[model samples]
Target chain A: MALTLMKGSEAIAEAAIRAGCRYFFGYPITPQTEIPEYMSERMPEIGGCFLQAESEVGAINMVYGAAGTGERVLTSSSSPGVSLKQEGISYIAGAKLPCVIMNVMRGGPGLGSIQAGQADYFQATKGGGHGDYHLVVFAPASVQEAIDIMSVAFDTADKYQCPVMIVADGMICQMMEPVELPEMKEYKVDLEKKPWAANGHGFSKKSGRSIINSMYINTEDLTVHNQNLQAIYREIEANEVRFEAYNMENAEIIVTAFGTVARIAKSAIDDLKEEGINVGLFRPITLWPFPYKELHDAAVAPGVKAVLDVELNAGQMLEDVKLAVNGDTKVDLLSRLGSQMPTPEEIKEKLLSMREVL
Target chain B: MKEVIVLIGNYGSGKTELALNFAFRAARQGKKVELLDLDMVNTYFRLTDRANLVKSHEIRLVSPNFVHSSVETLSLPAEVASAFALDWDTVIFDVGGDPAGATALGRYKEDFDALPEGSLTVLNVVNTRRPMAGTPAKLVRLMRDMGRPSRQAVSGFINNTNLARLARPEDLRYGYEVIREASIASGVPVLYTTGRPDLLETFLSEGHDPAFIGEPMAIETFMHRDWETFTKEGL
Candidate 1:
């Protein structure tokens, strides 16, 4: 495929389409509105369905209904909007329906600034909704990574019958870049393949009347269901911990970050390398699986001094870094909350200051 | 003599960035510049979002009234309607996206029509990387179609093809070729081959400087991926 210049949202929408997404239900939100806008333009041409839900709550439930049909369904929104969808997301997770959610995060405790943010790390990774469940969250740093991860995200959601969240910051959506869009998947939306689908009760005679609900009336049965969900999460954690270790060869410190911050820090790490500070970066690709072992190994390598967790939020991912480092090394945080972002020079300064402390 | 230039282009074609640069450059030259952001359709990453950046310079940004309100309602203010009657040396309308967005310009038809012939120029910004407007034919089609709803004939073309931070000197030459072909096809002059200062310097250093309309305007990118690099003050 030839590279074409496209905005991040458009690229991701196109990626979902190529990945066999035939239904896109979303609401208009800052940063991520273009995702639904693009889908609205393309979905009809490809015989797909694009519906702009009245609200994020309505959108996620629509995704829930669509996913239950065993079709690749996508719903995207920003911070506040994603928060609105949490209940539906929890319900979808509980029901074990496969679907993909893309959150182009913005700063917030409420309706925060329309700027890029990674504050949703905890909400996405630790399960924002009330349930003993974990969402497989992929945090991509660049527009290309975000686009590339969409197809895999849908597949991963389908494979585990779980909801996978592609949580990129607003920059990844607002930025323009040349992307090689994926080839369209040769996928037939076969309800028979999904024997468990409530697609008109498997589109024919079905298994036990095909009821899709999270309500397990019996307490013991619910316990077994919760256990099964936990087992799936464990399986995910074991097989799907994805992260990148940059310049860790004889690194005195690890500037661990995720998503857009990781990219900015990578530039800072390169600059720091030229300035004689043996610093590196540990960027987690999967926020939920957390890359604990790999991160711990990188942090505990010989001559490694300390670890610095940086983020767009006020150190939400810092907790995860602490858990990963697990006292194997000293851990600190450098962050700017809300809509503010630290430049690469600022990141370099923070790393240099950390070096001085070590 | 006050000059009013409206910029029209496809989505993601660097119209707002060019408008900001043109406004700032003219203001820096001591011109009383008034910028009318006719792009309410795009709520974020538009001129209204960069109110602080515009304030940092000499330019007066005529933002919509409801831009900063609790309601994200998009409505035209008196200032937008009275943009032409105002006393400003240079007025740049960062018009909305494509032909669809050009309808915003249609509302100011009388204001644009009353302007002296020599004082008005609607320049179509063509980013060749966007395949929808990549070729000479497509560029011409955009020039003709975008002019209809905009109520102004596109007098020129601004070749803004770029990979942003990844842009190089050759990319300029590539865009120049496509845009130059479109310019020839439509008899629309190539006003400026705009690029970031760094990329322009690289192009000059490589000794590929060619004769076109003046020196290519070196734009200060106000949005897109490197937004953090420029929006620090705005935030």
Candidate 2:
């Protein structure tokens, strides 16, 4: 496919459509509003449903209802909106339903600024809602990666029968970059084929009724369900941990970042390389099943001095990096709080300053 | 030769993309280019987002002070006033999308009026796919709406009909016919039509008029959402 420039949020919506996601429910939010806007225009033409719900809470519940029918469903929102959908997301996860949710994060603790920030790292990776559930989180650095990740997000969701979250920042949601879109997949919505789907199959001798509910009244049943959820999370952590290491071998300082911040860190690494400073970059593609083993291996590699966690928020992902390094090396943070972004030069200067400690 | 070009269009008419491409094209042709990003409406996908890229191509970019800044204010920077006084071979104003967006251009009405009579050209960009300019009458109405507020006459129209990477020769033809009708109704000439470089040959082979086509300018869709592609691999 030829490369065409696209905004990250719009591309993700188009990719979901190509992946045969026929049901979309979302509300308007800055930075990520284009996703719903694009879906509203394209969904009806493709024989799919696009609905602008009254609120993020309503939108996520709609997704929950749609995914219960075994249909590929998608919902997108920004940080505050994502918070509103937490109850629905937790319910969807508890029901063991498959759906794709996108959180194009903005600066937030409350109703924060409408700019890029990685403060949601802990919220996304460490269950946002009250539960022992873990969502498979994918963080894309570029528009192309956003497309590719979204193309498979539905499949990943269906394979595990769990909700998958594509965690991106406002920068990725707003920036335009060249991307090659994926081919449209053939999707058929046949309720009869999915026996587990709650598509009005009445309780009879031949057909068994399927119930979709998150309320496990029995304590023992809920405990076992929690155990099963943990097993799934363990499997995801074991098999689906993805990360990209750039110039990690023979590195003095290893910088860790994810999503758009990782791309900026890569640029900083390149500039430092030109100046004869050996700085490597470790980008976690899957935020929730984070590349812990890989990051630890890289941090413990010979001649590795310190690991810097560059982020748009003040030290949210630094804890994860420190956990991965496990005292083998000092894991510090260089961040811009409240939606501010660190430029390549600023990151390079921080990396240079860490040389004395190394 | 036109020294000043002002682009006005409905929302999603590809006006900003066209303005950016035109600035780079003029610079590549050895003309000193100055691009004024007069888009104060939409925060994202503005010319200021590509300021460094435009600067790299030697095109001077004049944008609001808060562009790409954390301030998020809509106040225009003082540099925009100096843009009119600066001497450059080509000065392009990338007006914001929609009639309301064109109101920002009113601040520089006197500077634009003081230019040589034929040197300043206001081009209304049209795409048939956009709701505001889907028909000839709607296109004309959009032109008048934008022209009145900006205090600039719409001298010509640029047919930028496209569906991102899915643009077919037939799509361009459909857009051209709509633009043709719009031109006759509004009495404004069709300056040129833009499309992918690869599709231009197909447009000509399909018997599109060379007169209305003008020189085949290779216009790329730089402002697109992420899942939109230009390749025919799947189709």
The 10 consecutive residues of candidate 2 chain A with the worst lDDT sum are A199-208
Tens digits of per-residue lDDT, candidate 2, B1-235, equal: 4489899997567888889889888998999999999887667767877777799998888997777654556688888876678778899989888776899888788888788778888888877765346689878877888888888888788888776656667657878899888888878888878888777667767877665665567786555543222111100
* B9: Cα error in model 2, Å: 4.0
- Candidate 1: segments with Cα more than 4 A from true spot: A190-193, A200-209, B20-34, B43-83, B86-90, B98-103, B131-159, B165-235
DockQ category of candidate 1 = acceptable
Writing each residue's lDDT as its tens digit, candidate 2 over A219-312 gives: 9999988888889888888888888999986899899999878887887788778888888899999988888889999999999989999888
Q: Which ten residues in a row have the lowest lDDT in candidate 2 chain B?
A: B226-235
Candidate 1 residue-wise lDDT at B91: 93
- Candidate achieving the largest TM-score: 1
| Model 2 root mean square deviation, Cα atoms | 7.1
A1-358 per-residue lDDT for model 1 (tens digits): 5667888888889889999999999999887888987888788878999999999999999999989888899999998999999999999999999999999998887988777888888899888999898899999888788888999898899889999999987778877777778888855656655667876644454556667899999999999999999999999999888898899998999999998888878878888789887888999999998899898899899999999898898889898889888898999888888767778888888878878878
